[model samples]
Target: MNRSSARRPWHQHFETVGSITAIVVGVAALFVSFDQSRVMREEIRASIWPALQVDGFASLENGTLAIGLSVQNAGVGPALVERVTIRHDDSPVEDLDALRALMPPGADLSRTSLTGRVVAAGASVRPFELRYPAEESDDAIDVLNRLLSRWSAEVCYCSTLGQCWVASDDPGAPTMVDSCEGQPGGDF
Candidate 1:
């Protein structure tokens, strides 16, 4: 071939290489986005809900402490749980693994001691009855306030993906996003 014709083949080769490189980069970017989305969903699933309010602590009926509470479900979908977790002064009293294993899929309330109750789909306030030993003390208000004062009360819910965490400043208030810069242990 002549010199001009030989140069034409080099130009075509350059064009082909460029096209392949562009396609590979595009595909790699798409995969990266997909992977990042998956990670975010899992983080949300494990987010903990901060307890905002717990009402009616004046009376204890036969070791049964009835209190109304509100919880925020920050996950993408509804949070369903069979066994609720009842923390003693903010400490976990129930074994998370055992509770999860016994929980029937879609079961809202726990058959065992008062721990976690089912919060409705996308619900902000979930009302349920909680019972604790009467010997526990009528000082429930003091205990609750102490727990709330710390401003770290969290509720773990079973999501389709996994457990997610959420938090709020006031226990008597609904949970809200713990701004990234504000709270130290807020997000996943």
Candidate 2:
């Protein structure tokens, strides 16, 4: 065979290198795409995140004693309240009426349902309110303080995006949950 025929073609070497480089680039592109998708999903969740807080308010002002329990939405998105579990001294209270029975008589009490309610961002829903004359403030304050000490609440809410969380009167951050199904106690 001739000398030129004995040597391998240079273009064949280039072709091999080109094929390997193409595969590496393709794999790198796939990883980048996956990361971008993960980031996008996180952004979507954050955009509709909802935070709920169970708050108690009491004040002796304007010759009136005002005491209230409310659920506030502090997040940027609306909170869809799914379930509410209210307890007194660690026992479940069946409904609003039962809760009201635990309060002192002679005070005007008003309440709104928390379950199946929608709380908008930066808005609050007063689930329970008690008003008494300032002349009764001293007695009301003592009773109210005792009542509050024995009261606790747990709220399960979802974001507009369907992300679920559980917030309670306990001290801690809200916990993420798969769903807000089958909570104990009657709906309030």
Candidate 3:
């Protein structure tokens, strides 16, 4: 009932409640910020191509070396392969033929071109093929055989977002190894 004592209790209560509320808000904000940062990082990693697989071998027809690749999208978002770097037997080859002899005729690259979205998250196997204009000879066949037996192709893509993805398949596939995906890309 005394004025001083009554005011003291109210003041103490106010201070304790205010401090607790401030701490709770601060902790909540920190957790939210951390979660947002994690999500952003994950999104960046998903936008890039994660892996590549060789479905089969490339085919040799006329004077062209046809190759196949199975590109996969292992990101949280879609990806495309706009450019490619292929190698045969650990050596880089300029033309596709240097690695086509070992593949069957059906795996020709003449009609292979990545169009729509290939390889979605958890979706395996986006088959693709490649071709090069060059004659097939005995020596070339030997080279092709060796190359197809141990061939690999790296593919690059452009996304509307600001980033791209790359996927590769060792050896080859029945479809074009290079594909295109049109999706808004974001900076990683």
Candidate 4:
């Protein structure tokens, strides 16, 4: 046999090694990209988490003539209110009378008005007129504080991503917990 007819062993080994190295690098890059994508998605979800807080006590806004209860969205994103169910002493509060009964035992609530319903991020519903019973009270602030200390309300809200939860100021408030896995916050 002629010597020239034999294959070059060194060249063949070099080609094989180069091909294996290229394949390993490509696979590693693919895995890294997937990991990065997952991290990005998680971060996006966190940025838009929603949290709703219900301050059932009636209050007046600055330069406003009316007083009304408030709901605030204290999260990073806007909150869409699904339902607002209020209870006073475990009894459903459907009207102003029920709400007045739940107040500081001396609230009139005759001039009550619902100023706003939609709660934006870091924003509160407008104040509407809320009257209190003709009891010898020091001031409106004192009455509000007293009422807040003994208020009960439950609000269900959701985010743009359709994640939802139930929140309230009442102790041991229950959360709806629907499609909101590991959401940013709970009771506001």
Candidate 5:
């Protein structure tokens, strides 16, 4: 072949090389995009799962011994509570007022229990309280002891992504369910 004709093969070779380079670049871009997407999904899962715990304590609030129930979110995200059912004497105590009314006349209770609550990560909600002066620590102690024996609370909470859980002050580990629609803990 002549000189001009000989250059045709080199031109075709250059075009083939260019097309292969473009395909390799596109595949690399796709792989990088997939990796980034996977990482983002993992981060979202870590951010949305929540863990909550319920317990009681005798705390010093306003210079008085106060018996209180505490619910805390120890997870990475906020806990969206669907229901809080408090059981007393083997029955559902929907009204905290009724429990307060059962207390002695001198006992100071605010019915401030954290019910139907949403707790953020690393946050605590402690509302159920019965206050007693320092000299009346025995009253506080008695109330706390009575509450431990007579009361059990269950919290049905969820995550922002719609995952659900049931946590209880009763015996056994907290169980995770698909939804709170059919799963009601304790009496309520």
Candidate 6:
């Protein structure tokens, strides 16, 4: 109605606009903080990622033919091996002795326990090794071929960050898992 009254209403409108702007800015800051936190978590997990692989080797050493199975850590972080399930024809192999029984006579066998072992990055551990005289290389080759066809090995491992995965000789292995608990097969 009067000049002073109209000026007062305009001042009030300015105050309301200021308040709304402040609220919008505050909400934007909160969202930015949450997004930054999510990115930080992803970076930390990537820094400690672990990848395990099962590999087989056949070589000649000191006049003996050696056949071996090894688990290698190829990721940047160490892998804590939780379980090892070795199978023959879809049935779990009980232990080192039981695995050896499947080999031919005169084939010397040795193994390292994989369960609860920590394999450092870029390191490897032989879980099974068999050696015999080079004179019997033919039979050893046959045995190795047969064993490879029927044998399978799966290793469940975790990273330092507590993420777990299952690695095996099968295709598309090294799948992410929730945890290594209740993995099948005897501890070996």
Best by lDDT: 6
lDDT of 6 at 91: 94
Off by over 4 Å in 2: 1-11, 136-144
- 1-188 in candidate 6: lDDT tens per residue? 77875777544777788998999999999999999999999998887788888966677767888887888888888999988988889999888888888767788887788899999989989987889788744555675677689888899999888999999987665899999998786657
lDDT values, one for every candidate: 0.44, 0.82, 0.52, 0.59, 0.73, 0.84
Q: Which ten residues in a row have the lowest lDDT in candidate 1?
A: 179-188
How well does each candidate superpose onto the true structure, as a TM-score? Answer: 0.36, 0.84, 0.44, 0.62, 0.64, 0.85
Which whole-number lDDT from 0 to 100 does residue 99 have in model 1? 32
Q: Predictions ranked by lDDT, top down?
A: 6, 2, 5, 4, 3, 1
Candidate 2 backbone collisions, by pair = none
**Per-residue lDDT for 42-127 in model 1, tens only?**
67654543232323232356665433344555444555432333343354434434333332233233222222445544556543
Question: Residue 46 error for model 6, in Å?
Answer: 1.5
Q: Which candidate is the best by TM-score?
A: 6
Ranking of candidates on TM-score, top first: 6, 2, 5, 4, 3, 1
Off by over 4 Å in 1: 7-9, 12-76, 89-118, 122-154, 166-188
| Residue 87 local lDDT, model 3 | 63
Candidate 5's displacement at residue 129, Å, is 1.2
User: What local lDDT does model 6 show for residue 134?
Assistant: 80
Residue 103's lDDT in candidate 1: 26
Which 10-residue span in candidate 4 carries the lowest summed lDDT?
Answer: 179-188
Name the candidate, 5 or 6, with the larger TM-score value.
Answer: 6
lDDT of 2 by residue, 97-138 (tens): 787777767778877888898999999898878887777436
Give lDDT: candidate 6, residue 152: 89
Which model, 2 or 3, shows the larger TM-score?
2
- Tens-digit per-residue lDDT, 1-188, candidate 4: 65663665755666787998899999999999999999998897789876776664544444222235566677788777666555545556665555554444543344422222446678876322355433343455765666555555566777777777877766543375774334332122
Model 6 scores worst on lDDT over the 10 consecutive residues at: 135-144
